[model samples]
Target: MELHDRRQAPWHDDSFEGEMVAVMTVGVPGGEVLLETSRLLLRPWRVDEAVVQRELWTERDPRVPPHRRIDEDGHPTVAELEDSIRTHKVWSTGLLAVERKASRDVIGYCGLVDSGRGATGEPELAFELLRRVWRQGYATEASLAVVGWARSSGYERLWATVWDWNTASRRVLAKVGFIETDRKEVDAVHGTTLFTTRPL
Candidate 1:
């Protein structure tokens, strides 16, 4: 797929009054999420990535847990993932592509997922990354960016659901200011999931 990486401040040295007004009104307030930290870029999920299924799905890396791996071999099949992405559940909300800037390779994702409604049933946050990119502080960086996004966009809080055994994620959540608030196991999914929350 042709990756468009220039989603950021379009204004440079060249400026026209008409364009400048447009930039100030929309571009400045609507900051593009091309978040970078010298290593990775936390960008939106792109469509057209079927060939990456095996690598993203089946790999037994520490970065992702067993349940979330949609593929048996590596990554989700292009067809399956595209289907997921097309669904409003996956496409409208939830998910991102964690890319290594130097290589433009999508190692994995660190993003938020909508967990239905809160007491009033608000949105939720879920995140993950490939094992190859784990423990290098990329998760924290991307998550912080997500938090900023949630706050800037008027989200009140961000929540996370994680397996009890995933101490690594627990730590990352704490690092990003999430505290263990509640726990519930989705019988439909059949695994004990801890629900943690933090104000945006």
Candidate 2:
């Protein structure tokens, strides 16, 4: 969800490279999800769950853009987020909520998204977890499930973008079979964006 508006020349940065769930649920907007992991459930986000998304906004690192965070004006307020959830397609090709089975608490989201860096029909893998859930293997677990799902869905390739300094996410991506490519976008304020790819 941290796409940049500024475009820059792509270059080779040899910094690093790296990088699911199941449940049967219907009537959700995310295309009849049947994805689950041993301890997680990847399902469509609910309208009432905007508060969860809001919490994620609060937990974002300061380096994250002001627009993506809760600004002084409280932009992207819960009501706006709820409206977005009500209207956003999310279909089978959008991010789904990552919910822990034992507690039924949603950690965050993992799935594919239409990224500008990718070709038509080639979606990018995206994921984010609550700070409290970090290092619990939830991100890796949910990401693996998404990869399997992408492979089964006939996608021949998947892309991912991460900040250069985010070693944690870089490790997760490497663990999941994504290799860092030469393509990169540098933002002076936010840092460099690294692109990675995996072929199914």
Query: lDDT per prediction?
Result: 0.57, 0.76
Q: Name model 2 segments beyond 4 Å from true.
A: 1-30, 91-93
- Write candidate 1's Cα lDDT for 24-143 as tens digits: 111422232344444666655666653443455655444344565654464456777777765534532346676777888877776556556343333566666777777987677667
C-alpha TM-scores of all predictions: 0.67, 0.84
Relative to the unseen true structure, what is the C-alpha lDDT of residue 45 in candidate 2, on a scale of 0 to 100? 82
Candidate 2 lDDT, tens digit per residue, 69-168? Answer: 8989887899998998888766233688888989998889998887778876668999988898899988988888777766655678999999998999
Instruction: After superposing candidate 1 on the true structure, give the runs of residues whose Cα lies further than 4 Å from its correct spot.
Output: 1-38, 60-76, 86-93, 186-191
lDDT of 1: 0.57
